[model samples]
Target: MAANNITSTHPAFFLLMGIPGLEHLHLWMSIPFCLAYTLALLGNCTLLFIIQADAALHEPMYLFLAMLATIDLVLSSSTLPKMLALFWFKDQEINFYACLVQMFFLHSFSIMESAVLLAMAFDRYVAICKPLHYTTVLTGSLITKIGMAAVARAVTLMTPLPFLLRRFHYCRGPAIAHCYCEHMAVVRLACGDTRFNNIYGIAVAMFIVVLDLLFVILSYIFILREVLQLTSQEARYKAFGTCVSHIGAILAFYTPVVISSVMHRVARRAAPHVHVLFANFYMLFPPMVNPIIYGVKTKQIRERVLGLILRKDV
Candidate 1:
């Protein structure tokens, strides 16, 4: 029943094209990609290490930053290595199941990142708007529960993707036009009708991105109202200052996603390599920028990092 390594349902492997229509530039393109990946790894690791080492950073905001760093590490690692392999060594083949596993980690961690951002927004809102009750509301136990709930939601929602993809019959060749095994890219190779997968994928993406973004915006609105009502201008500035890092993180994470999603729907107008580049950008950009945003903007993280550097120099 298995002919040429393809079973009745799927092929034995999928060939990942590093970037469609830009094969000639793969080697050149890998330089920036590798640099970004390296930065993402080092930056996120430093964030985690500093947060863990500093007892002063055990509060909810910094804990959420720690979570963000952890998720960025996993999320970028999921695809960047394989992408580098493809670009540098021409190792483009991914086993069918391995592709699915990569897809799961990539998407799940991405959703977790979004949820963590929303949690951070809530944290900022409470700190500014309900300062008296901040401790009572976001205790250590509640933060742990929130983290668990984020993981649970992502897992429960994404667990079905692999199963659903398994049902499709892939008659199209095993060549995928993009670097990673994105849900839509893989679904396109299936000869069978993909209406369900398309609908499901869009629905899930909208549910996560839109719903989380709406709440994040709402949280900020309340925060803004509370800040504006403060009689002291200095108090208002201090409150707004606290949210700068979170705002940067949110923009860094969501902007690429939003642009890439929009481009996907209007694919015919844009070139193939453009879409692939944007996909890679969204996957790599947030992780690379997040630590920089926090390190530069958050006073505590910056001071801790400087302290470590000075100690090492001594």
Candidate 2:
């Protein structure tokens, strides 16, 4: 049955875009990716469990953390399994609809992650810069509304991508050279001009990602200024300490994305595999490290997670 499905659909490289000289090691190369996938799932799941079970963590910051973990799980799941299948089972063929679905979820979760980061930044800004109004500004209702807005923003931004993709007629050699159905790789297969898609993608990215990053930076700037104004050394330490985890997470998430974009454009030949590896890192690294960041930075979550682990061991 599966063989029939493979034969019926045109064999476009849905995810596993093989590198030029590294095709031979594709299977072996996947070992690190397998490890990454496992660690991401386990770590993010642990974070999710800690947030859910701990009543003290029912605040807006942990709520955003939980949402981020969920987004990471979905984002990683959308790409990694297909890449693993291609590497291990030699099943590189994916139907057009399946590819579209993958692209949608991948992009959606990515946008959502960016939005969540922005929300987290806002949370920090309120808590640090406006401690007096933090309770009023970041109410549970407001957080729920922000979460909805994030989802809506993701959906609205990604709505046009699939429609644009559907208009294109793919040409021969539909092999995608990456590990997953990335926007650039899939669009490159179009026989028709993709200038519009590229333009719109850039516009959307600028609006969503760049704008969110700017907000995060501005929020931190305000936070830092407020922290500096505090006379008490203990108070200053407390203010700075709250943001350490968030700052670390933001760097881990965005730095790889910026690096990947530059690498993709400058080095076209090796870009596919490099792109795949870094893209995976962009999604997985944040999730895997987020728990550690929180554990090291947040006293409540750290103690709860440790207590839970020790209880299980006992």
Candidate 3:
């Protein structure tokens, strides 16, 4: 058994030590988070069902949208359930191994989501900017190849994180201050040197997230140029409108991550709580809003989903 006399030397210890007014707020916060999780699950599942059932949505864009929905389901479910349990049920204790496992999946899925967004951006670019060969360019086999490559790239980039985390010796503190397992939080518990983990984490973040953002931006730039060259104002408006949902989804996913990263470095005492809240929002908000975005923007998917619900009622 690990010693129970261990104490945390993390910089945020004082803030987490039963702060006034904030100590018991977890219960209340869990209510909204639970609602968000429920909505995310239902919304993403509905999107998936609509995509699978509607034969008209068998194009590359819808296929990528379905893939995004699937990723959102896995991504949100990874942390929200345990977070809700911790908050609502007062079950805050977690085994070290379980915490590490949770961190692994959380990071892995986040990277995968970033890759999927990049793929979606590329798909849009090809459709709008290279309409002459859109079908030949984004065939089923090509989409499969892109999906496989994204998965492989995410796995390869994240594979080292767990191993690096395992190198540290934890100080036997089982109660994490935040609602969910985070990479920096877990690593801070280590009694050993953590410089390597910090460096590696930053490197992976730059490679997967920063690089992916660059690619997405470039894709959109070309897409915008192509749209401007179109002679028909109606066609240009339609093409630009089709991209609004995707742009919103990307902003929803990446903005919180950027904010959380900055908060982690500058506001050590408050980062854990803010990070947890925003992390939950970042993971679930996209999933919850994505289906609605697509439904409002894509006529065929909206019609098919509504038709299916109406038929079931009849």
Candidate 4:
């Protein structure tokens, strides 16, 4: 039998430790997490409603924003509710299969989010660098294709993770020191060799992050070059203005991910709660802030949001 009295080769369930070393503070932590989840729901739903109802927002940029909003909603929903459940009520037991499902959604949606951000960068690049070709380059049909491709790519890459995990025997124990079924954390609880799971997870993460970051950077460089070539200061300013929201979205989404990943790898001796907090931040911050960034920086979205609030057209 395992140290925790778990004897089966594969436990039927696992217990989630909301945040190791922070059990006493779980109630306090739930407050912020609850607020973040509520805000994400309100913001993303409103954003989706506005984009869908307004014919003027049928353009590629707004369409991509809608896609991003959808992803944020799903991505946040997959983790936050369960986390809040664990924190608020101490309901931490999750069925083994359910854990795998949650892991799939979490990882798959994250990949899709990265891909959509890359697509949004391309949209901005074409809109600025090749203004005349924007319409021809990113047609409605093409946008649909891009969205589908992103989903397919994420599914293809993440589909094997649960299967691989299922093949292992979890003799270490049933307790996972994470709020959600994070790949590495779960892998660590298995008795079998975890080198492949470790390497595969890291490789997939790097493949998506590095490639998407490279493309985003390259797109921005060309955008800067094109903006600089403009003779009018106002023209350059206006061109740059359109990208502010996307830039904010990128930073909000990627910064937590990179920080959490680095800390996981290098800060092994750091406080356990610190690592858990960063992981939670990666899931919570982006979804909660993405709509605010867009609503504040994108004039169309801002105006529509204000209009909805004031019950009058701006």
Could you tell me the TM-score of candidate 3? 0.89
TM-score of each: 0.97, 0.91, 0.89, 0.96
State the C-alpha lDDT per candidate.
0.94, 0.81, 0.78, 0.93
- Top-TM-score candidate index: 1
lDDT of 1 by residue, 50-123 (tens): 99988989999999999999999999999999999999999999999999999999999999999999999999
List the pairs of residues colliding in candidate 3: none
Query: What are the clash counts of all predictions, listed in order?
Result: 0, 3, 0, 0
Q: How well is each residue in 1-314 modelled by candidate 3, as lDDT tens digits? A: 34323322222221122112355787777678788888889888998887897787889999999889998898888888877776666666666567667777888888888988999999899889888999999999999998998789878877787677665556645455555677776676677668888888889888877899999999999999999999999999999988988898898888888887787778878734566666666767877788888887778878887898899999
- Higher-lDDT candidate of 1 and 2: 1
List model 4 lDDT by residue over 1-314, tens digit each. Answer: 36434332578899999899989999998998999999999999999999999999999999999999999999999998899899888999999999999999999999999999999999999999999999999999999999999999999999999999887889788999999999888999998578999999999999999999999999999999999999999999999999999999999989998898899779989998899899899999989999999999999999999889999643
- Per-residue error for 250 in candidate 4, Å, reads 0.6
lDDT of 2 by residue, 1-314 (tens): 87544333443334445443467897897787788788778878988998898788898899999998899889888877887887788777887778888989998888999899999999999998788998889999999999999999999988888788876666646777766777877877776578999998878877876899999999998988999999999999988998898998898888887887778678777734576667767766876677678777888888887898899999
Candidates ranked by TM-score: 1, 4, 2, 3
List residue ranges in candidate 4 displaced over 4 A: 1-8, 312-314
Prediction RMSDs, each to the true structure = 2.1, 4.5, 4.3, 2.9
